[model samples]
Target: MKIAVLVYGSPTASSAAATAYRYARAAIGLGHQITRVFFYGEGVHGASALAAPPQDEVNWGQRWQQLAQEHEIEMIVCIAAALRRGVLNQQEAQRHGKSAANLAAGFELSGLGQLADAALNSDRLITFGG
Candidate 1:
């Protein structure tokens, strides 16, 4: 099966994001294909390169990055939501005159059109978080 995941919760503030990650991993393990992982609202924090969790805590951003790398998943952050939360790519940072970009590697900032496309293309569109 082809799946697309939409995340809507913060990595630290809720378990929704972690649950999404586990679901993705399990789906892949079961020989399913994940077409896209769309991060919206507070879930955009999962793509923040500047995130610094405590030494004992798992860095969800890094975990997502690794997952994307290993599985070649299309990880996308909602441009509007991400921008509102101060998560910027290099181009966006430059355009907005921000000092730096905090978007983690393997994740791209895109529009809702991507989400629409994912929904249309995938066999299942699963939403996590809020």
Candidate 2:
């Protein structure tokens, strides 16, 4: 199956983000293909390289990065939502005159058109957020 996951919750605020991550892992373990993992709203935090959780806590951003690296999943953060939340890529940071880019290595900032494409092309579009 081709699956696309959309997350809109903050990595620290709720389990929605973590749950989505687990689901993606399980899906891949079961031999399902994940087309994309789209992060919108507060979920864009999952793509921020600057995210440093407590040592005892899981760094969801790093977890997602590892997952993307291992599975080659396309992890995308909504550009508008990410920018609003201070998550910027190199190009966006340059364009907005920011000091540095914070988007993690395995993630990219994109538009809703990617989400639209995911929905249209994937067999399932699972959303994990409010």
Strongest candidate by lDDT: 1
Please, what is the whole-model Cα lDDT of each candidate in the order they appear?
Answer: 0.94, 0.92
Q: Write the per-residue lDDT of candidate 1 for residues 37-112, one digit (tens) a residue.
A: 9999999988999989889988888888899899899999999999999999999999999999999989999999
Q: Quick one: best TM-score, which candidate?
A: 1
Identify the runs in model 2 with alpha carbons over 4 angstroms from their true place.
none
TM-score of each prediction: 0.97, 0.96
Clash pairs, candidate 1, are none
- C-alpha lDDT of residue 91 in model 1: 98
